[model samples]
Each structure stands twice: as structure tokens, then as C-alpha cells.
Target: MLSQPETSEALSGGSTGRALVIHPVSKTPPGRVSNQVASRSTGARLDEAVGLARAIRLDVIRAEVASVSRPRPSSFLGSGTVENFAELISEYEIGLAIIDAALSPVQQRNLERRWQAKVIDRTGLILEIFGERARTHEGRLQVELAALTYQRSRLVRSWTHLERQRGGFGFLGGPGESQLEIDRRLIGERIARLKRDLDATRRTRALHRKARRRVPYPVVALVGYTNAGKSTLFNQLTRSSVTAGDMLFATLDPTMRRLGLPSGRQVILSDTVGFISDLPTHLVAAFRATLEEVTEADIIVHVRDAHHPDSEAQRSDVLNVLADLGLDQPTEDGLIEAMNKIDLLDPTTRLGIAQQRLRNSQNVALSAVTGEGCDGLIEMIDRRLESASRVVRLDVPLTDGKTLAWIYQRGEVLGRRDDNEAAHISARLPEEDIARLRHRQRLH
Candidate 1:
């Protein structure tokens, strides 16, 4: 919830101090929107919540899992549970309470009023983290847009104390607008401006993508769950010093670098923001400009933390995000799974993973930390990109040196023969390069 008082402090701009992380495990039946996540233990979820707290440099004084058989409308937690945590908050001098679930705006207000402390839910916590981690102008813009959108929904939490209507404007009607209406109108205007700026940014990105298409470099995008060693693998493959830490969302902005594959093909490798379970829709929409890079990619590499117990579940989450991005056919589009963190696995499990990779042409087990099997991943990438290319025969006039040079520069020559009037060449080229060649021929 967003408010001018301590509630605002919790959701938007909380200070770093003693914090209590709580995960409410729901016993609700399947197919309902509950706090329970599949393929992960309650302890693991609580631990992840704690990690999220620490990512923002918060000193986590206590971490606990509260079981909720039934949710209370006011506080989301039962009275007994809320009272118990209130005591715990006081005992630990907790300044903030982090709830690892989505809370209604009313529920958030009620909780804060009861505990007498700042309370933040999962969405707010994630927004806060993104707000702090954003560095680029576009990133800052997107974060602010998302934050404002989120705040707009919870305006009821603010100005509740100012129920009395202020005097009307001079020469205006008798009734005056409420503070909530004023804040809503202001937020709506800001959101409109943000949309305009983001639209321009989106256009600029489309132009950049168009320019890259002209260069005809195949783009390979890396995607996976948060803290799944994507940045580590990016650094290992590109040798660029991106911040690769053992924390969620270490890389927020999209990063790209030129990578030379084993087949001597130069491809643009993009490292994108990692996906998480139950990611906020506001965030997904805000980062659409950044995610368009993935949709336009020539190939996608799904990096996975193979050692994590929830690795499979993490894969599902990433795939779901990709599907939401209109990439429902990721596997059919030739997805490559790079099973990272093999170094952490025991010898027997690692050997099994290696064997499995041999059976599955799309899987590659590797350790980015130790540079193990990374070459194999690169080789796999080369093969996947190679498979995406087509062999085409072109007849170039002897005097058309420009066309001949363009083909040779952008494609691999398979077979060539020179005649008196023209050169008949067979070459493998990417679809984009092929289209360009055809367009040039049509113009001639």
C-alpha cells in the first residue's frame, strides 16, 4: 500500500534497518491464487524472501513462515497470527515487515495499523529493489512508471486522515475535490507522460534493431530464472565484467556483446533481466521495451542453475514469461538449455547430467565459474544458428563485384563456379541475409 506516513516508508522508500521476513504458506486447494508455490518447499521460499530482503542491504533480524489455513480479509493473517507477529516485531525492534505474498491495499493498511510498523508485500518489495537497481535513463523511467502505476491503485491508503473536503477554488463550485482525487489526477498525468516517453524510447529501440538487422548479425539471447548464474555465464562467454553476484536481479538492464562462435560466426549475445515466479505484471509491462530484444533474437539460450532443487520449477517460470512475451513456441524455435553450476553437483550427478546431455541434443551441462563445458555450449549455439541458415544458389554477373563481395562477406561459400558472364555460387546464409540478397537481385 502507498501512504504518506510509515506505509509509504514500507512500500516505496523504506530505510535500511532491522527487518522481519515472513512467508505465509497457504493450504488452499490447487487452481486458486494462493501463497503456496509448487515444486518448492516452504523453507526454500522463506529463504528466498530473506535473500530478497538482503539484496537491498536490509539487516534481516528474523525470518519465519506463517501457515494460513484461511485468510483474514483485514490483515490477510488470522488475528492470533497477527498478534503473535506484532509481539515478535516489538521484541526484535523490527522497523519493517516483509510479506512474501500479495496483500490487498486494505489488508496492507490494516496490518500496518495493527503491527505499528511499515509493511511491504512481495510486489512492493520487488518494485523497491528495481527502483534502487535501475541505472540507465530508460531503466529509471520504466521503474518510475511501474512504481507510479502501483501507487495509483493504492491511493485509498493515503489521505484517509484528510476526509474533510478543502475549500473550492476561487469562482468555482461549492464542493471541493478530495485529496485522493487530487493524487489520482496527478498520477494519471504522470503516467500519460511516461507512456509518451516510453513510446519514443520504444521507437528508438526499433530503429536500432532495424540497423542491426541490416548488419545481419544473428542475436543470441540468454534468459533464465533470477540468480541462475546468467551473468556469470555472460561474463564467461563474453569476457565482459558484468556484476555477477549470488543475489537476485544482479543484472536489471539488458546487456549485449559480440561473441565469436566456434564456427567463426559473430553473433550478438544479449543478457536480459531474469524471470521470477509470480513476477509483477506491472514490471513485465514496464520492461517491455527491454524484453523486445528477446522476441527479436535469432536464438535463445535458457540458462538454468542445475544444482538448485527448484531448477525445474525455475525453468517453467522462465518459459511462462517467454510465452507471455508472445514466444509460445520457444522450444520449437530451437531453444538451447545450458545447465549451469555443474561444478556444484557431485561427481555421480554431474556424470548423469553429462550423459543426459548426450541424449538430448539441446542440453549442455556447464559450470560458468570454472569454465567447464562452456565451449560445448558455444558449439551448440553455433550448430543451432547453423541449422537456422539455408543454402541458396545465386548467379552474380561478373561486373557485379559489390554483390559478390556482399555475399562472400555475409555467408559461407559452399560451392562456386565462374563462367564467362557470371559467377554461379552456392552459399549458406541467414534468413535476413538471404532476404537482403534477394532484394538486391530484384533491384538489379
Candidate 2:
């Protein structure tokens, strides 16, 4: 858990606030930033950090990558380096310093004092984004749980905002219980309560999922790095009006819609929250229920920004997050890759992507903005779903029009033979649908 540092909005500037973004690269062993994907360059990672701050309307005044041979215990940067950056901070009147690295309580507070500005680590910034964008009650609860978990660890940071803010009787302490201890107790109680609520929500979500399973539509979930055009592609395929934007963390809550395939088969297309490098541990734990949609999906579609320079790195990051959720996430028929935003790619890169697709049947280069190659993506999904089905034979009485209609509605009829009193029908259907149909018939 990372503490969410306070940010100041400059009242004088026409913009929201002046923000300084920095990506710290360390060579030493301890406190090294390991969450970053191996393929993403340090420069690209800094650019992403800047974009994250901008997502919340922070006016980035300066950005840079700082090289650190070793981390200092007090400020996480050498005294000279800290002073140098502090000079720049004072010169530019920057209100926020977005550090693209994890910071300890001591390091965060010391840096804030030295720089005379509010400071936040990568985890804190991500949490702030999740907190702001979460719409549903469950989503908001999850964010709060994560935020509180983070705040609990920063009691030693000497933040004025956390001082005497929580109200409670000091029975535990005889006379003068420090504000820090009271705040910690309040946060702990809140965390436990939130866990209870989240557990109940999880059970409810499970029930909802079970009901969806009975509907017999296979679930296809879309996942990718932030700003990968998932919502755009989702709207393009499902004809839904889900909010789509060219911003980071644009879609915080999971959304699902019944999508019809070209084969007359229907599937539930789920657009989930985007993944990012070094996703906070608390967030991963808090949003477990929301991400269960991916785990339960019959087929996962990985949407990639074809134009992003770090697209391959982003793919690796998404896969890593899925792995954390215990998903194998193989690039087999169960996983289809949607190479989205091809319209933003150059002619040469677009052609290269097209050539690359020939080597991988599980991937389709597409432009959600232009409706190009979407049909191929749909056809690919149709084929994968079709391959998962098997043929089953059923006997229905000639008078049972309802059962026959149900079979037709749920499965592809392969063959039918009518005898004197009953109809012998052979049809291809998903295993779950077959079980459901058999269960329905047994109940009748």
C-alpha cells in the first residue's frame, strides 16, 4: 500500500496546477523498481507517468528521468540530487511532484519538506485515479479499502490532514492517545468493515455470474493496458454507448453487453478496467471481485494499442497482471489479440502489423476508429466459440413445440429425424448449454 499524498492546485495559474514528473532508475539491489516491464524504456515509462498525472488534469511543468546509483534512506535521493531538484521546484513553483517510484513514509515526508511541495509515488497516484473514477458502489468501496490500507502505513509521515480528523473516544488510551494512534484505529476499523461489505458484494456478484451462466452465452472479456482503445473497440463491436476517451483509466468499472456473433451465436462481451505497469498491490487485492470477470471468461481478448511505442511492453504488463490473478493467459484459441488503434499507426508499421497477423491466427490488426478489420475480429471470435461446442442428440415428443423451440434457440441443429411420436434431434451446443437443456428437460 502507498499513501496518497496531498496535491495543491495553484489558484493563480490558468491551468489546474504545476506538476513535476520523474522516473527514478536505480542500479542497486534493494528498493529497485521491479514492477516496470522489461521492454519499456525508462524514458517511455516517464512519459507514461506524465500522462497519468495529466489524466487528472495536472499541468505538467517539467518531466525527467533521474539516475540513482543507490537510494538514500531519508529522501530516496542523494542530498545533492534532492537539492538540485528542489531548486527547480522552487524556481517553477511546482505544486506537485509525481515520483514514478515507491516511497517509504520517511522518504515521502522528507522529500516533501525538502522540495516544499506535495509528493506522491506511483502507487499513490494510481490509487487517486481509481478513487476518482470509480462509479459503482462496489468500485468506490474497493478504492476506499485500498486507500485506507495505504493510509494506514503512512502514520509516521506527519501529514497535517490526517491530524485529529477521525473522531473517537480515547478509551483505549488512558489520557492522551496520539492523533496517529486514533487515526490508525479508525482506519483499521474501516478496513475491516469494508472487507465485510466487499465479501458480501463478491457473493452477490457470484450469484449474478451464476445467473449469467444459466443464460448460456459464453463470456468474452477484453483486457489491455490503459488507453488501449478497449472501450472504443467494445462500442464498435457491441454497438454500445459505453464511455470511450483518449485518456488514461477512462473506464474504471467493468461493463458487459450481449453481443451477437456472425454465426448467430450470442456472447457476453465484458470490457474491464485497464492494466498498468506496477499496479499497486492494494488495488489488485481490492478489485479482485471486479477482475474475476476476466478469470471467468471463456475467451479473453487482449486489446493492444498498435501505435504505442511500448505496445509490446504493455502486452507483457497486462499478461503479468493476469498471471497475478492466477490466469494462465495463453495466446491460444482461448485468447485473441485485438491490435487496435491501427489508424494511428504509420503506413509502414500498419503494414508490418498486417504481416505479423499472418503468422498468428489468434491476432487481428484493427482500427476501431475506422471499422477496419473488426469483422475479422468478430469472425475469429465466432470460430473460437464454435470450436468449443460439441454435438449432442436429444429425443423430443412431437407435441413438445416449446422444447424444440428452446433447442433451436440454444443450439445449432445438425440433424433431425422424426419418428411416429418423437423427434430425434442432433445439434451442436456448448457443454454448459447442453447440461442446462438436459436439466430443463428433466425438470419438465
* The candidate that achieves the highest TM-score relative to the unseen native structure: 1
- The lowest-lDDT stretch of 10 consecutive residues in candidate 2 is 167-176
lDDT of 2 by residue, 1-444 (tens): 112232233211222257889899876567666654567888888889998988776789999888787788888888888998988888888767878999888998788767766777888788777776878889888987887788787764322222222211111011122333326777789899999999999999899887776556788999999999999999999889998899899999899999999878888999999999889888899999999889989899999998888999899889999999999656596899999988888899888988888898888989998999999999999999888788888888899998887777666677899999988998777777778877867322
**Per-candidate TM-score against the hidden true structure:** 0.84, 0.83
The segments of candidate 1 whose C-alpha lies over 4 angstroms from its true place after superposition are 1-16, 28-37, 156-182, 396-427, 431-444
For every model in order, what is the number of clashing pairs?
0, 0
Model 2, 262: alpha-carbon shift in Å?
A: 0.9
Residue 222 of model 2 has an lDDT of 95
TM-score for candidate 1, please give it. 0.84
lDDT of 2 at 17: 56
Our tally of clashes for model 2 stands at 0
lDDT of 1 by residue, 194-278 (tens): 9999999999999988777656678899999999999999999999998889998898988999999877778999999889988
